[model samples]
Target chain A: MSTWNMITFQDSNSLYSDNLISFHDFIMLFIIMIISLTLFFIVDLMLNKFMNLLLLKNHMIEIIWTLIPMFILMMICYPSLKILYFIDEMFNPYFSIKAIGHQWYWSYEYPEFNNYEINCYMNNYMNKNQFRLLETDNRLIIPFKISLRLLVSSVDVIHSWTIQSLGIKVDAVPGRINQLNLFSIRPGLFFGQCSEICGINHSFMPIMLESTSYFNFINWMNNNNN
Target chain B: MVKYTQLGNATTLETPADLKPKTAPYDPRFPNQNQTRYCYTSYLDFHRCKKRHSEEYEACKYFKKVYTAMCPLAWTTNWDEQIENGNFPGDI
Candidate 1:
């Protein structure tokens, strides 16, 4: 649910994305705490008449400064590292989708379905309900509440396949297959664009992924076969 | 979970439209962000691919796509000439 003028993060529909938002909030806590402490110290120094002209060598102050930053860093390390590894951990995916980047468009293939490839181009001509430069003629559909492994590659220059709301960004380089792990708890439509500048039409190629139930996905597959 | 069992017996999926075409193996040699090494290495890989397999091998064309994407047309054309003249430095 990324909107044009939205300032904050979009809603989280997956576990990892929710964890990512929690981590962000955790870091923001530290930032606000440090800022408030500094502001208090600055204002007190200016308003109070507590000026000491004596020698400024104190073991207590030195120990406090050294130990405080060390403790803060340690506090920050565990959660950050935990999130880094947690997002990277990939369980056995339920399905696989291969996304290939082209000069101006994207193609998707369901290797589980005998390499069923679909060329998804930008739907420039769209009604008011559709998003501009963010919608494609054919959308990549995955089952809701299922884990998936997405393989990304490029047929031309480097392009990046990323969905910010999902907290996933992967480089699609020619001659290589980069893998991204994804799982969603709820069903929704997510959109992204080729992050890496490939050519003149870099901003044109967009990705629209829809998540539905397993039953509907099967029905869609049956209809697509005809 | 019982519903998911239908996938095994699913019929063939439809072929995508040929909208016109073709990275990545990771190598320590090209660790940097700039992929110039990929440009040249992919060229050599295409030739090496054609050499090991038949020229018309489907997989060999993968390397060709890699090189075409990484290297410019002029660079590939020049390398093609060098390969034909037998003056290319890289061994097949």
Candidate 2:
């Protein structure tokens, strides 16, 4: 967990989140703030001038103001649309995992490798170094730098499978599977919790993912098979 | 409130003792002593047991009971080293 003074996002672990934070910074600091400050100064100067009544009625000013805003919007829209399409693009993922949200806990299923499944429960007791509510009994492990597809659904009620650092949040709704693409740029531990209000133990259901090297993941798969 | 028996017969409301399992002492080794806590703690123990003892994981009676319904084979064997180092999370 990051302190309140931390203005920026947690160092992005995945490409999706990194792009998202950069786009946000560009829009907020570069585009919107600069335009607003420029407009504020111009409007203040116009208000101080004595003969602004005649100039206010000028048709050229109206057209310029409207067109400038439209142009700015076009600039914002281009990247927004590009990112949207980029996120929606489903390249052939190396493997797929199904995350099923129960009343509280999350059950993960690896359909690609013999349909292996694990029910991740919250760790009520914690060690000195472990996070209080963010730790789980089992950590979902994946290989870094690989595109993976996550299919999310719910068994009891609606729960969102969200990881802030990974920039992935998909609703786990009953009877409907929502697919999301995950591509980690590096290997590290990322934590997230169920973002939906499901029941009494909703806050306890946390997600912990361990992104490891490709070689380590292969070794894990081999060792576990026996 | 409506009161009904197991056979759907109308009857006076009665608290069933079987509904609630008593809490027992907490033991890291055999955390599943209480049936109610067992339902919750078994999930943690199954993963912990297999990770600590991969080859003889099936010999763990509690892990075997949980393996029957809760955990899959490949998932259990992956954490053998983590359990040995006391890095696996949970009370057990």
Candidate 3:
């Protein structure tokens, strides 16, 4: 994320993040409507001089108010639940990568290729174009346009594997492996960090993923293997 | 190891039919977000399955695959050492 997206969500790189952003906008529309409607009512209460002398309570208004909220809730519930299930749907993965979290670094492994490992530590030295704390020594390279699986675990303490652009966040808990689906729509560099604080250097354990084509990924694998 | 033929000549990659990566199937017994019990139980079940049947038994290999995918290599490596020493906590 650059300075532009620091206050908001980063540029979406997957369908999950796109759906999440739309859902956020959908909820925000209701929030703004509710606030404005309440403001109008408050203004009406303060300025109105007319009073209904014969009316104690109106049944029509009460029913309308109750049913309107129910309708609105149903509208919100449908898409919210749909996106939740959609994100959880794990398609057949083209590649499966395992990520193990340690005290201040994240080590990744390609389980298919004889456990090809890449230990990613924080990169203190950075160029002007790179992010300061978000840079890492190794980037977890993946193939875009193909659905992949990410298995997350912690070696010692609990950590969180997160990438906001893809809307993927899985808790790296010790003694267990949690999996997530990863499908980037485009080729780019996505950055994240260990959201769950394991120790003092938890802030230093950053994650960087470089998305490329499948052909390039295979070449990278061959080169690393050799 | 899985390899692709489109190394340098082709722009697109066609994965072979047998290149699908496999992971542990979901078990309903441990149906929570945390999978610690799932990994531990799978490890115990694999050893127990080995004790009941031969190592080459097809069904015994299923539990081994689950434990291998879900648990860290260090845990299984140490557990193998304990099994050789006959100091493993859980009964086979």
Each candidate's TM vs. the true structure? Answer: 0.69, 0.65, 0.82
Instruction: Please tell me the TM-score of chain B in candidate 2 relative to the true structure's chain B.
Output: 0.32
Best by DockQ: 3
Which whole-number lDDT from 0 to 100 does residue A99 have in model 3? 88
lDDT of 3 by residue, A1-226 (tens): 6565377778888878877777777778898999999999999989999888899989999999999999989888877777776676666566567789999899988866666889999888547877889999889999888777677898899999999899889999887778777788889899998999799998999999999987898899999999
Q: Where is the poorest 10-residue window by lDDT in model 1 chain B?
A: B1-10
Interface RMSD of 1: 12.8
Candidate 1 Cα errors over 4 Å, as ranges: B1-92
Lowest lDDT block of 10, candidate 2 chain A: A49-58
**Candidate 2: where are CA atoms >4 Å away?**
A1-4, A30-56, B1-92
What lDDT does candidate 2 reach at residue B81?
A: 60
Which stretches of model 3 miss by more than 4 angstroms?
A: A5-8, A51-55, B1-19, B22-38, B52-63
Give the best candidate by TM-score.
Answer: 3
For all the predictions, what are the DockQ values?
0.04, 0.01, 0.15
The better candidate by DockQ, 1 or 2, is: 1
Q: Give all candidate RMSDs, comma-separated.
A: 9.7, 20.4, 7.3
- Cα-based lDDT at residue A31, candidate 1: 90
Q: What does candidate 2's lDDT look like per residue over A75-185, in tens digits? A: 767766766666655544566677889888998877555566788999976477878888899888887767676767777899989888988888877655566676677
Q: Give the per-residue Cα lDDT of candidate 3 at A210.
A: 96
